[model samples]
Target: ATGNYLDDLSAESHVILTNAKAEVEILKAQVGDYLQFIRNGYFCLDSKSWEQGNRVYNRTVTLRDSWAKMKQKMGL
Candidate 1:
């Protein structure tokens, strides 16, 4: 739904919200994994993992915003 749909797009918003929630959960788990991996000293100052975590965090924020929109549409 891209977070800009009109009020009549609740169906699409619901679909987007479902997918976004799933993605958020997965990305959160991935971040947790990265944290554990880093703690194990697999690589110090690992740019790749840090970059991935940042990307996931950003996506999660967008998804959460989208979810908020969906909830508002649904009158929740």
Candidate 2:
């Protein structure tokens, strides 16, 4: 989804991710806290949903695919 406010009004661009094996410490994350989801990217906890007792994270930046770069270097 896009991070642009005008492009994603209604928060409809949000995607719900399921992590059944996530660490317990994730539950302690506060609103506005930036978190890195391993191979995924950086995301911030949504404040509005946090106030409503929901865990909605908005992706901020995506992780660069180093593997893709390696593939390109190998001309594959």
Candidate 3:
């Protein structure tokens, strides 16, 4: 999906999901603060956006889906 498989720019699709809600503490997060979003992934406050007064978060890592992998291995 988001990963590029070829050199063509149209080969990859970019999706932006915005306006998801978060805990109140997220409002107080400073730049470079690391956060674990439940069932989602780890994220960090985007320093550049913070400097611009925007509460932007960049996903650092995706949560591992062991169950999904197991199911795939089993041909489910």
Candidate 2 residue spans exceeding 4 A from truth: 1-13
Q: After superposition, how far is residue 7 of candidate 2 from its true place, in Å?
A: 5.5
Looking at model 3, which ten-residue stretch has the lowest summed lDDT?
A: 7-16
* lDDT (10s digit) by residue, model 1, range 21-43: 32343444433343222112221
| Local distance difference test values of all predictions, in order | 0.38, 0.84, 0.80
- TM-score-wise, the better of 1 and 3 is 3
lDDT of 3 by residue, 1-76 (tens): 5576564555223345587877898898888789998898898998987888887777788899999999999999
Show where candidate 3 strays beyond 4 Å: 1-15
Q: Write the per-residue lDDT of candidate 2 for residues 1-76, one digit (tens) a residue.
A: 5877687666645566676467889899998789998888898898998999898888889899999999999999
Let me know the TM-score candidate 1 reaches against the reference structure: 0.18
- lDDT-sorted candidate list, best first: 2, 3, 1
